[model samples]
Target: MTDQPIRVLVCDDQELVRTGYVTIFSAQPDMEVVGEAANGLEAVHEATRLRPDAVVMDIRMPLLDGIEATRRLAGPQAADPPKILVVTTFNVDAYVYEAFRAGASGFLLKDAPPAQLVNGVRTVTGGEALLAPAVTRALIGHFAERLRPGDPSRTAREDIVRTLTPRELEVLEHIAQGLSNAEIATALFITPETVKTYVSRILAKLDLRDRVQAVVLAYRIGLAGGAA
Candidate 1:
């Protein structure tokens, strides 16, 4: 962790939602609410000026929208982007997929418990990503359903799988199955700490940004599928 607090920018069109987040996060000593934006355009401007460590962004905002804002801040065009957490009140599947595709580091339900919210911020700030179990499964399933023989990136994904050690490969398969770290450890008879280490190593070896990416990779490489 850095010596300074984890700075956060909260963006939500609803005043109550923004106030709620600010109130909850500001109570923590390790984090601080650095700024607030009512719309996606303001979010981009505030993000540029404040450069907060993480952003709690809502998907539907006035003017520009979370998807476009996220794309601008953490997408392909970004030079140096801050981590973004997409927290929405809805559980619409398309929204979840779009949030991840937009390069958000994490996704959370707007009503998630305070602890989960806090942990989500910390996870992204630590250069990791977080997705709900349902969202994770959806991402993998989405990719597998569209799998094609002549896909241009197939070979690259296969190469990523080839680099994984035997143990890491096992972990990857379980991740695609939507198992949590503790559950994976229990099923494999390994310690959770060991599972954590394996997960980190798998991400490094596979050139994945986080577990979410690892899940997608597993499905892409045919390790996890309908018959998996």
Candidate 2:
């Protein structure tokens, strides 16, 4: 890891929640609060200027919404998007799904324990998607709908997936199912190092940005329906 502490931008409409995040991040020796935004539009502007290592985004705000802001800051069109970790008070699957589709790296509940909040920023900034055990099942369940055979992107996605080897494809399936390297190794009777190697190879071969995109791709091509 870099010697510099992770820089973070905290965005929320609620004054208390925003302050709480700033406090939590400030207390971490490995993290620093670089900026704060009270609304989504401000979030985009501040994030653009501050270029923080990670963004703690809240879903609902006036002027713009967190999902749209996340899209603007981290969307496929962004030249160099920062890692974004969306924090929501409600367990709305649609919002969570939209956040991911818009390019957020991860998400957690506003009521998540302090340790979870701290670790989430670190996890996302370190380039891992931070879907908790509970978030994974719910989020992936919503993610699966993007593959419903009738979606327009399915054909192209299917063609793109043809690049993977059989072994890489197996690894991709486990990733989409939210299995960690160790868990995948256990399930496949291989070493975690081997699983990590396969994961890297799969990402390189598929031209994926990270495991999150890999999961989306797996679901889009119908590889996740029963592949898990």
Candidate 3:
């Protein structure tokens, strides 16, 4: 691998899928397909060996599943975990939500364009989580509809919430809705620059590292639930 290439490990049960990813990523000057694994177990083993910057793991596999594998590799309990980007053919919304809960940095459809796949890796490697706007809305809605009232963690969530200014909260609500910075700016009648600032501040105040965590926190705390 080149010193500057983004090293990636492709893990899937299907040989064609693995080969396809290798071929696509190999063609990119900024990326390198460092290794391939046929199942979650192998994925974890190879991840430990290669220590790649990003792991492209599928949701299903033998010997172990991606969810557990992701937790071992990137979960809150992990001592050292690589960023995981889940790859799946089915757009089943629930699986996407579970992937995030398992600490995935992003989720990309298997049929997504090669460019998007590459970009997904780059985004996660750059310390950002890739949440498509549509997916974001679905997750927030799902959590909002199911969240129990008077949650014990409500206080902690509120403590984090209080740090946000009213305008920052507005931007955050839009973010939980899966709105882009440009869309948020237009909706709030502010410049996109201001919206970006709000996003940065929100991340800082909430102590979240990226948008994916923000999205998860929004659901965890009922901020993005219900009408808002």
Worst 10 residues of 1 by lDDT: 143-152
In order, candidate lDDTs are: 0.80, 0.83, 0.80
Q: Which one is best on lDDT?
A: 2
Pick the TM-score winner. 2
TM-score of 2: 0.91
- Better candidate number, 1 or 2, judged by TM-score: 2
Deviation in Å, model 1, residue 94 alpha carbon: 0.6
The parts of candidate 3 lying over 4 Å away from their true place are 1-3, 139-143
**Total clashes in model 3, counting residue pairs 3 or more apart in sequence or in different chains:** 0
Give the Å shift of residue 35 in candidate 2.
0.8
Native-vs-model 1 lDDT? 0.80
Task: Write down the worst ten-residue block by lDDT for model 2.
Answer: 145-154
> Which model is ahead, 2 or 3, in terms of TM-score?
2
Look at candidate 3 and give me any clashing residue pairs.
none
lDDT of 3 by residue, 147-180 (tens): 5436565885688667888888788778877787
lDDT of 2 by residue, 121-217 (tens): 8888876774684567666876576556445556755665677777787888888888878888999999999998998887788777677778776
Each candidate structure's TM-score, on Cα atoms with residue i matched to residue i, is: 0.85, 0.91, 0.87
Off by over 4 Å in 1: 134-150
